[model samples]
Target chain A: MSDSPIVNEFNQGPISCHAFNGDRTELAICFNTNVVTIFRKSGASWTQTSTLVEHDKPVTSIDWAPKSNRIVTCSQDRNAYVWTLDGASHQWKPTLVLLRINRAATFVRWSPEEDKFAVASGSRCISVCYFEEDNDWWVGKHIKKPIRSTVLSIDWHPNNVLLAAGCADMKARVFSAFIKGIDKKPAPSPWGEKLPFNTLCGEFSNGAGGWIHGVAFSPSGESLVFTGHDSTITVVSPGTGDIQSIRAPYLPYLSVIWLNENQIVAAGHDCAPHLFERKGQQWAFSASLDAAVKKADVGFTARDTFRRMDSRAQSTTSTDTEVHTHHQNTINSIRSFSGTPEHVEQFSTSAIDGKLILWNADSISRGLGNLHL
Target chain B: MAFRKIDIDALEEDAFGEDEIDFQEIGELRPVADVDAQVNSRAQEVRSLLQRGNTSGALSTSLQNPPYGAPFHAAKARNTQTVMEVLNSIKVSDVPQLVKSLSPEEQDVLMKYLYAGMAAPEQNNSGHLLAWHEKLTEVAGQGCIVRVITDRRTV
Candidate 1:
């Protein structure tokens, strides 16, 4: 239980986003640059397999459809590309998506069915794109009515017809992304019935009014949770109209993922992921995944103490520059790496410090007894 | 008579869609209570507690149910003033003890007041606020400052 997480350093740059293939053998990551690199796992280490370079600007997000074996990448260039493996050429091919957005595209996610995908942009709109067979190209339908600011993050409901977006305007909204021919009429749920395209089923904010940084739905798609810049995570159940907000004693979280129906892991500027659990109708901060250790317990010696006193006027041996957490800088993104949505066995995080870490649920659950992950 | 074909894209480009106003739901949806009277009474109680040298009690009193909603800006301001006065009255040496006695929620509220006091240096003593700020951060860590800066609810 005291073992450290698996740490990998892709020294190219900070990984802005990353996605894994169905078998977790391949990884597609954007190194905060215009290029997206694909890495294939060779034993314990990963080696670069290829680079997809279509965007003229820094790529912001990347997502791989596990079932379809396709990758979608969106960038600040206001464009998105879907990459498919060409069997004859034995190379990855890029297909452009007509986003038609004037501003940078920030985030992208494939729907549950992988038949369509949504791209969130700084243009204050979301482009729900689908393949058009007649034109032999992809076309996008815009959801532009209610969003007043840039959308920061987005999540898809399991039903594949609903999209949840977190915006800089400090609101999280649930909208129907139901396309006429691509999606069937979704069954009635707690969100709403008679689902039409761009139908806003719900809107919410963390009462303190911080910009929403991340949003996610429960495994069953019955509950939604969003992390706000105000250092709070809010959970809402549209069925009961119950909204529960819990503010943790940590820095704001930029990303959140559900480990199970009742458990959530969120990480961001704090540089470590924290766990939140639901007990009955209430949700509260349960534990910090990266448990804090006493600094004096390790690496503080008499020589270091004298050196610290010699360098600075301080008499203490504490290192002021280094954080005690696993991640040295802000964690920009977190994704479920393994297990079912009902119980994610492992998860991964990428940070500004050019490190990608994989955390195991078994070790964490063992360390913190009574936790079910 | 031949009818002209309507291009949906062209119509969307020329026509204006209904703009949705993003209002803070906390302020408008929650009905305004008698916040002015409550804040005034709390201020008086906090002042009395400070005079009696009960800094911990004064802090709890000042932080309890801070007046929110847009309708009671005056009360919020007055409460901020009262909190600043209480903060200034505490001795520098007693800051650690006072901060440690506060719960996490109280510490967050105190942080909001510390920032508010620092914002208006003319109204509050900067040295006293800085002393309190250092102690609070030591007890609560950097998250308190982040919350104070990002949270929309002001003192």
Candidate 2:
């Protein structure tokens, strides 16, 4: 089923970032390299379609605007490019946007409206870029107050006027990106009523002295969830200032998302996505979506011990080399594979292991119990 | 079924107009820091520092405020048995750094614990100690814990 989560293992090398197109039939990924490769889906397998070779440095992040069918990528070389599929040549054409950040541009995201995008950079600023009609080029306006370190991740509010950033400075902040030139004055949201650009609306620390790795706005844009290097997932409700956090028992997760309003899935160094949900008042770990079933026992014998000792000069009872998870390396990015963010039918995860795994949301919820949906 | 690929043809006929980012603050600025969040070590803050290539920072942290639980907590407890128990869990990949990063006095103390652990009665937990011993031997040839043991012997 297209909605079933499947593990696509193409050892292109550790992937730095990846993006799937609107129909979930194509993918744009950087294989920890300067080039961005596009792949097309056949019935079950993906075939390489085209490669966009432009960035002088490794591409850091990529986002595909589903409605607009445009791909924007940022790289460590301090540049961001918007790629369009040329109708004439059937090739992706690149347009460089003026990010104006001196340090590496670390991450990029398209606003929900698709008319604008935000680029997070190592220079401690979020550059919100939009098409300038008179200038005929993408020009960026900088959000520079209060950000102290590299902006690691940014998410656009559903309203398309608010932006949230997770930075290396151990803080996640929400800012208004309402540019007067493009956006109609946005109506008041729970985050705040002020519609001015670069206004720091809400800011919260990741709560464990770790760099914020990822931040995502809840579908309603009322709550913010972020993963931290401290192996924590913290949720904030901007209206009440009520915060809920759960410290994971495994390695820190780099990415996090709300599966629905009640459930959130986060994954990173643990190499597996974990489920968290609120029950009444408190948030708690529910179950591991990628829990590896135990293998049949291969009875311990003298031959196994001798072989193990001969190889490493040590005799241990067990030599289980594999981590008991599906992903062999850190899962970096987790995006909705199928269905909407409000009710994700399937979700896809890409990792440093150069593997893209698509997971069915219902099946995962089934493993835990039943989903309200 | 194979789905449609995304391209310019997939886009709408009319393009959305864009605007320059207005840097001026147009709305009320909320004091965000007042929201409750912290950087407590319960989230493996020390490991985060170590992974970020802040080894010196990690070392100082461990020396200054070692964790009170698993890996660090045992070492933080500062008892010879607890230290050895923590040291025994070190992977071979981290053995060199574990050995190299500690102060000379700390290293000497760790070696003392290792020597003591070597003499402990072999049991189910003995495998890790032996593993650490073997790894230390490989990383430090003659200058490893053996040298410390011998130097103490001569003294």
Enumerate the candidates' DockQ scores in order.
0.33, 0.03
Candidate 1 achieves a global lDDT of 0.87
Model 2, range B1-155, lDDT digits (tens) per residue?
14746554246343211110111111232232211111134225446665687654544343332122222323322333434434544455677767666654344344445565666656225666666566555544333343344221110
CA lDDT of every candidate: 0.87, 0.75
TM-score of each: 0.87, 0.70
Best by DockQ: 1
Best by lDDT: 1
lDDT value for candidate 2? Answer: 0.75
lDDT of 2 by residue, A12-116 (tens): 899888999988789999999999999999988899999989999999999999999999999999999999999999999999999899999999999999999
Give model 2's docking category: incorrect
lDDT of 1 by residue, B1-155 (tens): 13747644464453322122223534443344577778888888998888898888997888888875556778878989888878777789988998898887789889988887888888788888988888888888876787777765656
Q: Give the 10-residue window scoring lowest on summed lDDT in candidate 2 chain A.
A: A291-300
Q: Taking the tens digit of each residue's C-alpha lDDT, what string does model 1 give over A213-283?
A: 99999999999999998888999998888998886878899999999887899999988899898788789
